[model samples]
Target chain A: MQKILNDKLVVTADIVLRIILYLSIVASIFFLGKMLLGPVLGITEYKSGLKTPIEFSVNEQGTATFGSNQTVPVNIEHAKGLFQIDRPVPKTLMVVFFLLNLIFFGLILWVIHSLWMIVQSVRQKNPFIVLNGRRLHIIAFSMIGIELIQGLANLIKMLYLEPRLNFETIIVHSKIHVSIHVIIAGLVILVIAEAFRIGVELKEEHHFTV
Target chain B: MSIRINLDVMMARRKISLGELAEQVGITQANLSILKTEKAKAVRFTTLEAVCRVLDCQPGDILEFIADEKNENE
Candidate 1:
């Protein structure tokens, strides 16, 4: 059977992978910024309770009103920290998360730089297509693994462990927007893989055999 | 495994300069030089046809197969 394919689609997919590399860079920058500045950002809690005491009996059910501002006393001796966050974040774990975020952020940056080199290789139409593509796809697809695994870990921690920690309702590090990055990374890796495969074939193909 | 490119031989016989041959074949002079030096891994039939036509030679004249210098396993 004869098979026909618009081979240019493969080229377009490679272009899309280049774009995805840029997208990954933007994601890395966001995570890096959060990790760096998140430490200093002070935390405050807002809680309001009935200012009016419960009545023994009333014709109408009691209606509660919250004043503009309410202040609570500081319980300093009960805790041990220089500037403790009133929130439920564990100090050591938060620091670990911060460091891991930096590590992955650096990995993302490395992938971005590699993407630039791959684009250069593609643009120059390098003769050694297999070697060029092998390096590029390794970095490109490895990023997918990194982002997906870390994202899954974050989700699992939020879901299963957060409750066991006696913490408030699930919070922290689970951004809806982050999935856009995961999907983008996966798609970009797939595109790079296809491009690499075709590019090697093209480089190797000749009208006749030896 | 012992096939060889006779492009240089044909080009010499036809007195066609490598630069002129590359220009006729729609490829770079550097690439033509590589092919003449037997440094290229493979060649396209379209390129071979152009060279053959320009040099008044056949594909067989531009390419050759010889016995191995060493054993096949080696």
Candidate 2:
């Protein structure tokens, strides 16, 4: 397996992940610079996209006019509700929202960085290094942390905007949601990290068994 | 480790160089150096037999066990 896959597939994967890691780092730096400079440049309106739960009341034709003077096209299958949200928020809310997104991006970059290191180790034919196990543990924890921040950010945004924003036919619901599959994936990675640690120990034992 | 390798002592007594002994024992000089310096985790019976045959000494002449204070306390 190593003979066939190690030369092409693993190297390609390592390169791809490395590229993504570098790009994400650059993007994060750009985002931070923009956030820091935007207010100083007299740009206070925070224009961004968000998805949230809503309580909607449709008219006789089963269509609603959103706060932004836009008509939401009601689907024939689900004529009573609309899912998409687009709004310009306050500067403070934008700062919090952008910070949360930046943190989420950072966590994703962390997972990518760890994955790239592990793949690089495999490319070098030394995947059982003790540090690789720690990298896997980092990836696992970062995954869980990403989900937690997502849920918390969503809840905070919902609660903060609940009383302030006035919509014509829709009310945003303050609901906190987390993806169970992502948490389960984090737990699985943790188990894999433990197994990798044990494998590294066994490899060390074999190395010194001369 | 409690188990100590006395390979250097045995080699000295036999007047055998590391390269010469390693070649005679069909092992690498680096591995022989590890064994001589007590850095090895375990010795195979084959390697021990070859070392003994080359040095004309028993296995006990090359390996010694000194009880650790930590182990004694435990």
Model 1 residue A40 lDDT? 26
**Ten-residue region with minimum lDDT total, candidate 1 chain A:** A46-55
TM for every model, in the order presented, reads 0.46, 0.79
Model 2 ranges off by over 4 Å: A1-6, A39-102
**A90-157: candidate 1 lDDT, tens digit per residue:** 44555555666666666676666666666666555663566666666767666775667466545544
Error of 1 at A65 (Å): 20
Q: What is the TM-score of chain A alone in each candidate?
A: 0.43, 0.75
CA lDDT of every candidate = 0.59, 0.79
lDDT of 2 at A173: 48
| Candidate 2, position B2, lDDT | 86
Among all candidates shown, the one with the greatest lDDT: 2
Question: What clash pairs does model 1 have?
Answer: none
State the weakest 10-residue window (summed lDDT) of model 2 chain A. A76-85
